[model samples]
Target: MNTFLYDVKTKCPVCGREFTYTKVRMSHLKVLERRKDLYTKYDGIEPFFYDPIVCPNCGYAALSDVFNNISDEGKKEILSKITTNWTKRKFSGKRTPQKALESYLLSLYCSQLKNDKDIIFAKTCLRIAWIYNILNDSSNENRYLKISLDMYKKAYEGFEAYDGEIQLIYMIGELNKILGYRDEALKWFNKVINHPDRKNHSLIVNYAKDEWQSLKI
Candidate 1:
């Protein structure tokens, strides 16, 4: 186990197996800045390195936030489609960036099998894109960025279960700018700028103005 990372015991929601995964120590994280792309830079350890946990025994994997929220039916589905054919592999001990990416990818695969909401999958893709960004791997970064953007758009247009419509609009605008969709970015930015409640969220409003100005330059 890496000194910077600590072991976290978790129960697999899909297979009922106990496992341990590495997590970055909170005390070690040093935040550098909040990028326009929404990724937070860290000086010491990356929290995202421990975001996805995988069960080595059954190949069940998901982000920590959603890992324990599985339904009985979802478990059955994963067992049938994922676990049954899954070649057992362990992800214990210290984790490299590449290993972390692999765990997120497995979680993504499981999310698809469970027919997870677009938002759920989009968030995963966004994290993957951020990971690639940290690695300076432009090809993979753009690939996941496009995937995440598409899913976020879908979720915004059709998913009523998701809260924070205004924030989602802001995110969509930021994502568009990241993808070089300047016109679309401006459209959403303006929407936030002109919203009735814009005054309530000074931070988001300020960000919208800054991004909107950048587009005009």
Candidate 2:
């Protein structure tokens, strides 16, 4: 057993089967850098590899944050669509980049099947893009990034006010910049800088300002 990772027991909401997944120890994490799009580079094991929780019993997969919150309709969908075809496999051991990519893609599929929030789709797509970036696969990276950007735009258009709105706005700007949409990126960054709640999110406000200024130069 790897000392940096530990097994976490969780009950599958879709199938009611108990299983364990691997999670990196927080103390062992060493952040080397954080990209503008919020992808972090770590010195040791990549914790992002474990962000998606997969059930060995059923094929239900989702980001750890939203794993236990699936709807009744979602459970029915998973049982009918995913669990029926799932092969018994374990994702509890150490994961390679390929395994991580598979896990994230599974989560993305499940999210779409469940009609989850656009933000959830955006988040998952963004992580898939980040993993592709790590693999130096620019084609797929841009592909997923574009999908993520579209989802974020849809989410922003639908929400009037909600938690993390500021951060969501900032992500739109950052991803636009990363994807080479200079004008769109600048417009979004300015929106963040001038937002009514800007003062409440100083960190994101500063990031927006930095990106905004960089674009002008």
Candidate 3:
């Protein structure tokens, strides 16, 4: 079947250069399977494999959510640190898993360069870990997962409540469990099960319950 991936026009926030970035049409996506941690495998092209858009003119890359939301300071930083050293490149064609990994890592670097929120860094690192998981590079995958878990922990400690906060807390517990930090995992999981927000987020509540129970067995 033909993959419904196409190019979308984008203006680089850092350099103000027009470029085309590839995206998968969501309506055409076919999910083959979804893993316990919510890693999805698609029948065709993976939509998430194209979640980041990189400006070919400059090296500024970001996840779609933050692509156009750069602050003036962020733009200045990107221009100084990335664009100034960037050579023209293209990421507009069909992307391999490795290419997608490269794009995500670049976005992670850019997020750090711009001093974006811990959530942004955590999300980028999570995606990088997922890519490594797909590649069966368990060492690299776990390394990024550790980084993501730390970032999430920091965000949870310092940030105010936001959308999906319940999910964030659940992820911290789950990541801790995956990393063999059983005590820490149980601590966070206990918090999730007792959190008032858990009532409103039934999905996370159920998942947390399941994980918590499984750990006790």
| Model 1 per-residue lDDT at 174 | 91
Q: Candidate 2, residues 4-102: lDDT per residue as tens digits?
A: 899989999988989999998978778899877778888867888999999999999999988987899999999898889999898998998899999
Q: Rank the candidates by TM-score, best first.
A: 2, 3, 1
Q: What tens digits encode model 3's per-residue C-alpha lDDT throughout 1-217? A: 2358777897787788789988787877778987646677888686887888899998998999888878899888888988888888778878889999989998988898888889888888988998898899999999999999999999999863446777888889989998999888888888889998777988777888888888888
Model 3, poorest ten-residue lDDT window?
Answer: 159-168
Distance from true location, Cα of 161 in model 3, Å:
4.4
Q: What is the TM-score of each candidate against the true structure?
A: 0.90, 0.95, 0.93
Instruction: Compute the lDDT of residue 128 as modeled in candidate 1.
Output: 92
Candidate 2 regions exceeding 4 Å error are: 160-163
Q: What is the C-alpha lDDT profile of model 1 across 85-162, one tens digit per residue?
A: 999887877667888899889899889877778888888999999889878999999999899888888988985344
lDDT of each: 0.84, 0.91, 0.85
The lDDT ranking, best first, is 2, 3, 1
C-alpha positional error of residue 111 in candidate 1 after TM-score superposition, expressed in Å: 0.6
lDDT of 3: 0.85
Q: What is the lDDT of candidate 1?
A: 0.84
Query: Which pairs of residues collide in model 2?
Result: none
Query: How does model 1 score by TM-score?
Result: 0.90
